[model samples]
Target: MKRSLPYLLLVVPYLLLPAVVQGQSKVRIACVGNSITFGHGLPNRTQNSYPGQLQKLLGDRYEVMNFGVSSKTVIRSVDNAYTTTSAYREALASKPDLVFIKLGTNDSRLPYRLKIDEFIPDYRQLIQSFKSLPTHPRIVLLLPVASFLTDTTRQTEQAISSLIIPRIRQVAFEEKCALIDLHALTIDHPDYFPDKLHPDSLGASVIARRLHEAVTSEEVKGFDFFAAIPQPASISSFYGYDCADFTLAGRACKVVKPRFAANGLPWIWRARFWGHEPQTDIALLDRGFHLVYCDVAELFGNAQAVAAWNTFYRFATKAGLAPKVALEGLSRGGVYSYNWAAENPEKVACIYADAPVLDLKSWPGGKGKGKGSPADWVIFKNDYGLISEEQALAFAGNPMDKVAEIVKGGYPMLHVVGDADDVVPVDENTAPFEQKVKALGGQIQVIHKPGIGHHPHSLPNPAPIVDFILKATKP
Candidate 1:
């Protein structure tokens, strides 16, 4: 979907926190705030909330919690019982290593008027509640997003800015917590908030990116080393099958010799990721190295057939190819790259997995044992040696199970997937694998294209990946 506002590119400022000071560590973070943190009116709810996005950027190392209530705030008011001290107490009990607090929006709009002195003290008490915790979690005060609608709401927001923000900053300084001036940033870029108050997906994405930059800038240092790979020369072939089988051409033999041969390459060849067959496109081939395209799922029913293709990296290595052979698998093809890379760490050099089916347990086969196509079920049963579907799933095709093994091996990988793809969900395909790769200290490069589909071959194209492979496969 095209964005209505240019809010995606906005950068959030740096935040000073203990997590940043401490560098990298497995810290538990909790988002305790009101409706804004609850992700009101957002299509994805908490899945794409600020905390959720932080989880993606932070990977699996940190445990992030979203303890936001729909109609809650810190101020005490009889009409708005939802926003009260009890909410604050519950948040304190969660005992997070890091806490992000976003309030004041609802508090600013509360029906009951309160003296500035009373409001300031109440806010101070809330900060103290978390500071009093035995664990003494690091805190970040998220300034409430600015309201950008009519003059009335803007006036109300400005009122809060005048009355609450100074105090919040003072409290943050006194309590020794990190203060993120989101209020000023959002005001500067009104386009970031689509509904004029709450953030749209793009707006949320911007906030998350800013938060990530802040944390990673201070906490993350130099990255692990990875060997460079080369790019494919040109488009040799794509995923579609030749139409000769179904056309009149099937019966008509060419009067002259066919211009291109499927076996034109000197090396043994099978699958194609882009362009047409018969011509040598460096984009598809790594010179001096055998390029094995294994599609076990049958290319989602295409003749270039591959299933769990991404996980089939070991097959190429086991076939006596050089240790520098690069792998490419899209959708179920990802199944091949991930699985093969996991098992044959020593042999395979790099991977180009696009929209891969990293987890078979959830795919081809749904959570239930009998959810996939008849062929898919049969393949799983036969390959893994199981009688029942559940047993087969329980026994085989779990990419996650082999993550540690791959991480220990430390192979270079490039993962490309679409953010909006409903077919091969990012969580099932690339997200978990990316997390595992990062955790095992392996090198993985991820490219996420927004508003794209599940076809990785098309979105990221084959050139860059081929390039990555060529450079990475050096002998």
Candidate 2:
């Protein structure tokens, strides 16, 4: 049927429009912050800033604008207040669907620290200002990265820890805004910050990856970990078995390819002890399960440590390994295993923890019956930004606190503990944890060795462990 020219033109254009144009709309994201957002000190400021990287990561469906001014502060009373900046006005004018606030690093400066009392109210006001906008953006508060500067007077990590972050947390809670813990993300990674303040290119990439994960509710997978391994790296040989020594996210990593690849290339993610317990790894290698490890020693499975593991997981999975991994933790490695598993429940197949330090309070904090390491305790507290023993006691992010999530994910856990262990006693660490898991209706198997201390992690034969792993990770 012939139609009128004007009507036919309109109808044809509408019908011929691309599916994308007719479907979901683009998300407008306004990245509002200071020098960090401004991409200062970054070589390729236009392309390598967190916002710029976020745009690439988000692809065509998102418009991530970098509206950041150098030396800007959330506090209006500060010498260079973000409220007075043109970037602030531009951010408001952009009418973004999402706004990420990464201020307060500059506010922690000595001059602005004096007016720190005004921070909460000022931050609240700023948040309200965004809320009042017609767009009513979904605001996310980013806790600032830790300062690496030795001069405590000018820009102190203590100021951010003691004054800024607590207030930021309160603001997010009160305002019902999402919070991304950048502080924890960058805490143990001092190498990320080249100038002791600004993040280098790699550091910015990490931040962008984290932000993308938060927004999309998806993990950044398929990183080529082996590609990042430096040239001329030495392969460690154990009894004619060769393992490639590589680096993932600047951390030491080892990959032992299986004799035969499983259907999905199912691998065992050794949380720690790359070479300590050869029996289990060798057995797994014989069974076509690739053995992998990324060193995260002394981190105690804090947010930073978990983040590193998350990166490693992505890299390994992308490198043709299985999407789900069987976690093996021996002694203190238990902390890394359970914590990483808890954070990423769906990615884990099962867990095997031997003589594990399930709770930091037992082996590290010394809050319980076990004899703790004083030096390690200090490091633990500092890694997590724990100011007092009371805070450490009250902290609930431990593996013990994550039983519900683990159960919900349907991940069965196995623990090997020593009954007479004093360093990390079963009575203090594994016993109570197992009880809680069972009480919560979670699947947990415990193998207790009597008259054994914390030493001699993993099984001598490893046949039983291998059997369990095979069953758990069966394709």
Candidate 3:
């Protein structure tokens, strides 16, 4: 009976082990950084930290641990170095499957900024330390949120923009680690950051959502675009493609071509939103379309910008790309896209403008029903050689002025605009523009996203936008 009892005990334990082990199998994620990750000012640190929010979003499958230390710098030479902390050691020992490092905010401080040169090496070392762990975690480097402080000499936006971020990007590239751009994510939403540094509960949620998207999507951060076009002297590889960075008539010009051209060589002329909200372009690239842009920023689609586009167009066409291309403009990009299409109607296939400033007067000039950029207004005036504010106010050469030319060309147009857009109000831009186009027998489709603003440029699923471009540019 004693021998039977021992066998029974062993068999019972073995029979129950599989279920317990299966239940325990959760992907461990270590959130390693400073106060931001620590949920410093949040009312409830346990539930409102980005790591905490991330766990909720990821459900029961992910065990996210906040290994954050307050005011710690990634730069090892700095006084409060993150590497010296217990959290650092624990993070390494945890055998985490994934690690999110958000440590550059403290490094942006003026005291730490002096040791800027040490940033890259130290960051690389940190990434390597995680990579060397037995767990072999996938490390993601997060660019810190923009400092809203106007002060330049201290830990301000200038320090972040000039010193920390560029180096961080370079380190991410050098280490071949994925990067999640928190800077771009929260730059517009200053309201989210009550302290202008540490995000509140709402801001933490935003960070968690973006992190979830970046992590779960398994997107190769800074992917190399395959280049099938002739490499220009100024061109380099950007996210896995051949990219040309040169000045067209002394203005910044960029061209990104895919590794394989779609049938008939379809391409998109990105009037604006070059770096911001690139999902549409990413989708188009997947469908075999080349993405190209010329920085007509502050030009407001003036004659100079048109000339630059003409030069770019000739260069692009001569390089064996399709003659007619789709135009993608977001916000101010609408002016460049529509103005260029109006001037050279024969070269355009379709136009997709999102919350676009079709009328410059509605935006920079502050002439109409929108809050305008006084600084950009000066640039807009200078670009057109306007001698006075009165001249700018009376200027008749806006995109709306060229509606006849655009409509005459039989080009299809799509506008994904916010009904609540006050910056480039639909009443001043798309509403009037659509009415004119339709009255003149032009084909235009408007997708009005309710309760949205100019901030979010594209739909969650860019399929409809991509479908429009594909159908318009079809051979």
Candidate 4:
């Protein structure tokens, strides 16, 4: 038998060559792109490129290689006619189980012929080169990450990704390869990317996880055609109505009106503070920061909430309060406080939600009710033209979502909730939020009083919440 084995050895290479030559990634992946995929700005090679992160997500099950080149152009290779003529040969050399191509960022700036005309044929040739290999790996063309603003350059890039990348996908589909649309995963997630263009390690991790799930999961839907569109500004700006008074019409508000008019757009004011047991006299009188309160529709006094909030802003301005402000509210007032604070984070110095109802989606009675009161779901639908309960819920954005946004931008929050309060449960209110702030590498002060119930102002000492503000807001 030993003597016979020597004769078989000669033919073994020929048999094994087919398997080796055919790209069956027992478990390997190849990531190829520009600096965006290469983890530019990351201090170490072992740090957070999407490829490095993808390998970690796959554990030992898959091997991922990074073949990204900074300032490299796919057009340079394609117009010249080979996928890897000495130029990108280094990237082509790392044969992989799966290949991810993230191109077209730099390609958008080149001559139109290079991006639209030459790119497809060049990409087709590249695909052919890979298919010619004994081990033909699966290929995935990741759409280029979206840019910050839709300027001329970014518009060009977006157009390239929107138009040319589809051709790449068609080639992948014809070849039976995988396709991952990172453009969708990152559509509304701006905080993930540090600069508008490149993914921070955190952003890279998000892309990697999305990619991993796309490859491994049975139900990986490509980017949604109708996902939520961000408002194109910070949630904080919405809360503050930031410069709405000035920017929209390009002039300062000259006089206070019964109905707020911005650029002559008829608008009503709603204040969330006022009608508290002890009264927010101290807050109303503060000359340091202007406070914009959003009054509940009517419970805290219908249009009166808006009236009171405006009065305060007017009074504060009269009293020499700084343009930057802070918000404070209790129980129902919490809704107004959170909303206003979130909308105007830059102007909002801080926020104090004293036993406030943060989420209307899941609130008292696990339902909403009351006229002019924001708690009612049916009313929201009727009032806001919302078609469904989910739409209604989404209609009113969640300020809690912006807590990290606020903290990251240096606006602190102080929350005081009763642990035993059923009206606004601790677990549902500020407790979970406490964890979020900690996770985001931000700081928020939350004071939990054990055995306490519903009303935060009813606490024996409301002074602590006040004290936190004084300390936080002080120059």
The top-ranked prediction according to lDDT is 3
What's the candidate order when arranged by decreasing lDDT? 3, 2, 1, 4
The local lDDT score (0 to 100) that residue 387 gets in candidate 4 is: 82
lDDT of 4 by residue, 1-475 (tens): 0111111112121012222445544465667777887788775645588888888887775677787776555564444322444435755666565677787666665354335666666666666666676456555567666666555544344665566556655554445444455554565567766766777888798778767755563211121111121123222221111211211122122111111111111111223434353222222211112223332453322233334454544433332234445566676566666655554456566666677776655453254321123445555355446687678557444545666555655767777777787766767767776787778876677877788877545333234554565555554
lDDT (CA) for every model shown?
0.54, 0.77, 0.78, 0.52
Q: Which stretches of candidate 1 lie over 4 Å from their true place?
A: 1-26, 77-90, 110-115, 151-155, 219-475
- Per-prediction TM-score to the true structure, in the order listed: 0.40, 0.52, 0.58, 0.39
For residue 441, give model 4's deviation from the true position in Å: 39
lDDT of 3 by residue, 370-455 (tens): 89889999888888899997898888887788889999889899999999887888899999999999999999999999998777
Q: What is the lDDT of residue 72 in candidate 4?
A: 54
Q: Write the residue-wise lDDT of candidate 1 on 261-282 in tens digits.
A: 1111112222334232222222
TM-score ranking, best first: 3, 2, 1, 4
- TM-score, cand. 1 vs. native: 0.40
